[model samples]
Every structure is written in C-alpha cells, then in structure tokens.
Target: MRVLSRVGCHLCEEALPVVDRVCAERGESYDVADIDADPVLVARYSDLVPVVFVDGVEFATWRVDPAALDAALRRPR
Candidate 1:
C-alpha cells in the first residue's frame, strides 16, 4: 500500500496511522509519497492528499476507512 500525502495535512496525518495499524497487523509494508515532492503528483493529488493505494491502484481518499482498508488488504494480490 502507498499513502499519497503532503506535509502538515491533518487528514493525511489521521489516515496514515489507520493504514499503518492495518498494515502492521497484516504484516504488510507500506510507503508514503509526498505529493509535493513531484510535480505530476502534486497536480494530480494536490487536493486529494491522504489518498491510499493498494498494489498501485487507488483505494481510498481523504479519510481512511478501517473496514474498507482491511477488506482491501485481505483481497488476493
């Protein structure tokens, strides 16, 4: 999983832990990408920080829904 976020984004701050907890429980590893670090990412996700991607596919945005995250993680990759 990957979290697309930027510095000082409250929603991103909130969503990251949910992703971390879920991934930790499942023994999975995830990475965070700062949208501001890349021009294209900034353009694509500037207003959508906290976006979550599973296997490179967009899964959630804005807030992390624990149930949905768990379910997505459980899916066969």
Candidate 2:
C-alpha cells in the first residue's frame, strides 16, 4: 500500500495513522510519498492528497476508510 500526501495537509495526517494501523494489523507494508517531492505525482494527484493505493492501484482518496482498507488488505492479489 502507498499514501500520496503533501506537507501541512491535515487530511494526509489523519489518513496516515489509519493506513498505518491497518497495514500493521495485517502485517502489510506501505510507503508514503509526498506529492510535492515528485513532479509526476504532483501532476497526477496534487488535488488528491491522502490518496491510497494498494498494489499500485488506487484504493481510497481524501479520507481513509479503515474498514475498506482492511478489506483491501485482506483481498487476494
């Protein structure tokens, strides 16, 4: 899983813990990318910080849904 975020973004801050907790519970690994750090990411998701991706596919946006994330993590790849 991955979270695309930006500095000073409250939504991103809020989503991180949910993602982290879900991933930890499932023993899944995740990465966080600051959209501002990558030009391409900024272009694709600047307006959608806090975006979550599982296996390189978008899973959630804006707010992180714990139940949904748990389901996604439990899904077979």
Candidate 3:
C-alpha cells in the first residue's frame, strides 16, 4: 500500500491510522510518500494529495475509512 499526502493536511492525518491498521491486519508493506517532496507528484496530486493506493491501484482519496479500505482489499484486482 502507498499513501500520497502533503504536509499540514487534516485529511491526510486522518487517513494514516486507517492505513496503519489495514497494513497491520494484512501484514502488508505500506509506505507514505509526501507528495510535496516531488514536484511532479505535487502537480498531479496537489488536489488529490490524500490518495491511497493498494498494489498500485487507487483505493481511496480525500478521506479514508476502515470499511472502505477493507472492501477494496477484499476486491479482486
């Protein structure tokens, strides 16, 4: 799982716990990348900074929820 987020974002802060729980439950390797660290990412994700992806596919954005993430993981890619 990968999380793209920027600094001082309330939504991003909220999403962190959900991702942490999910990765723990699934024993998955997860990483959070600050979009502001890269210019290209900043441009592409500035408006969608709080996006989360599981195995490279977008799973959620703007907001994150446990149930929604669980469902996305349960879904076949």
TM-score of each: 0.96, 0.95, 0.87
Question: For candidate 3, what is the TM-score?
Answer: 0.87
Q: How many residue pairs of model 1 clash at the backbone? A: 0
Q: For residues 1-77, write the lDDT of model 3, one tens digit per residue.
A: 79998889999988898889977886667889999899999888899869999879888888888988877777776
Provide the lowest-lDDT 10-residue window in model 3.
68-77
RMSD of each: 0.6, 0.7, 1.4
How many backbone collisions does model 3 have?
A: 0
lDDT of 2 at 16: 97
Model 2 residue 29 CA deviation in Å? 0.7
Model 3: how far is 56 from its true place, Å?
Answer: 0.8
Tell me the tens digit of each residue's lDDT in model 1 across 1-77. 89999999999989999999999988989999999989999989999888999999999999998888999899998
**Residues 1-77, model 2: lDDT tens digits:** 78899999999999999998988899999988888988999888988889999999998899989998999888899
For model 3, the superposed segments whose C-alpha errors exceed 4 Å read: none
Model 2: lDDT to the true structure: 0.91
Error (Å) of candidate 1 at residue 47 is 0.3
Count clashing residue pairs in model 2: 0
CA lDDT, every model vs. true structure? 0.92, 0.91, 0.86
